[model samples]
Target: MWQNLDYVSERRADTVMVLSGDHIYKMDYRPLLAYHQEKEADVTIAVMNVPVEETHRFGILTVNRQGRVVEFTEKPKERDKGTLANMGIYAFRAGVLHECLPRYAQQYSDLDFGHHVIPTMIAEGYRLYAYRFDGYWVDVGTIQAYWETSMALLDPDSPLQLYDRAWVVHTRSYERPPAKLGPQARVARSMICNGCIVRGRVERSVLGPGVYVSPGAVVRESVVMNDTWVGPGAVLDRVIVDKQVVVGAGVQLGCGNDVGVPNTTYGDHLRTGITVVGKAAHIPPNIRIGRNVVVHPHVDEEDFVSYGDEVPSGETI
Candidate 1:
């Protein structure tokens, strides 16, 4: 990403704004840029307050009364109470950014804004300012974070309001019709997107576009993405099913204890704290997947059935 930024810097002019797509939030950046110009800061980092216990998952900052950043820590081992965390959003004076990024890249191969760029600039006496944002923001970088944020969207009083006409989140238009619900379907506190067909029970779940929950199936506390097929009598709880997945009849996922241990066979992203069926996977009938298990992308019935009818907790397929 830094390498690509190097090329961008070459063509850019006065100021540059950087943002990470992994976050779930609503923000009008015009104000942020105005604040950056007002402060005349070399770099302005958008920050927000998170619970102290959750600070270990983020890049934390200590800001002075004037909003100037005094200290910066990336994913600190020890929590610092009342500290603001970096939102991975920044507005930089283009010259300052060009100066820092190339020099850092030349000096070290590791090139990330949080891990190297920001801290190094602070140490070099660059005037870094923190733009406080007291709005909803969640870093959906991990599976647990993604699941929780998705569930939060269902809350009537959630901080992240999607229905606010003033700040509409526009997306590509899907021509499909509204979600269809069967006569026996039971849905509660869930968000079923367009083109979905629910014939079973969905509680506290979020279903993406074109998802089909067959009759007699039960999905609770789960997030099922686009075009997935949940077969008849299947059960899904506390799980995340990715796009184009096929859950066969009577299959069960996330039915065991939540305890999990690390498995090095799969990548860190697949080692979610909850069960995750990756995109385009196929699970056979009557199969049981325990909590914290991961069925990798495009995995067929043969690969999945090799683990037998029941997958032990924490095991990845």
Candidate 2:
């Protein structure tokens, strides 16, 4: 926040709002700003009630009955702290923030809001208050979390209502033609974005713009990105294919059931039974890719020839 001091001052802004891009949710900041003014708070931190078991994943807050923040713990392993998790949304009094942050920057090398700023401000008797927000917010920082959140959009009763015209969600999009489906195409419970051409079976998957599913191919429980081509007789299951990739004819991606095997290169990150094909990678014809496998970015068909038609589970190409 201190880094933008000059810009904020240039704009003559009174209250500065900080938000996290990785989180997906709908909110109106007008009410929050109003609450901050009404409470005459120096900093208003938005918080939500998360599950006690999941408290370790967030910055827990202890607020009094008056909703003034008393304590702040960032990503605590122990859940003894309250379940009021920080949503990383803040409305700060610009004048107070401008004066306070620079002094702290001189003291701390790695200054973070949850770890440094909020905790120190509370200790110093700053008028930091908690704004309770009961809304659907998700931090999709990891691959599993991203996939789960995307899948949640398929639910009819999902709290994250993208269909709510009152609060519309805007996204970056490209100019593309209408999505087409061949006579043989069979789709069920899936999202086919504009410019996609489906000629085979797509079940419970999300196909991005301009994706092409060829005849006799099957895409199941996967997320295929923009302009990717699924060739004839290929099958993709529980996989994530990145942009502008090609799956050669008769290739079987994410085929095996060895979900227990972690990725050899990224054991901690890619061990959740998800095969990730990086951007612009090519899968060779008649090749079989296993669970937890990672096809690195820009890996070409010639690279797959070295694997001899089968990329084993837990391997990184």
Candidate No. with top TM-score: 2
Model 2 lDDT per residue over 1-317, tens place: 77877888897888999999778989898889999999999999999999999999899999898999988999889878899999999999998788878989999888889888999999989998999898888888888887788778777777898889999888898998999999999998888899999999999899999999999999998999999999999999989999999999999999988988999999988888899999999888899999999999999888877789799999999
After superposition, candidate 1 runs with Cα above 4 Å error:
5-12, 77-82, 258-273
lDDT of each: 0.87, 0.91
Error of 2 at 222 (Å): 0.7
Judged by lDDT against the true structure, how good is candidate 1?
0.87
Scored by lDDT, the top model is 2
Per candidate, the number of residue pairs that clash is: 0, 0
Over 4 Å off, model 2: none
TM-score of 2: 0.97
**Model 2 residue 52 lDDT score:** 97
Reference-based lDDT, residue 122, model 2: 92
Question: lDDT (0-100) at residue 107 of candidate 1?
Answer: 77
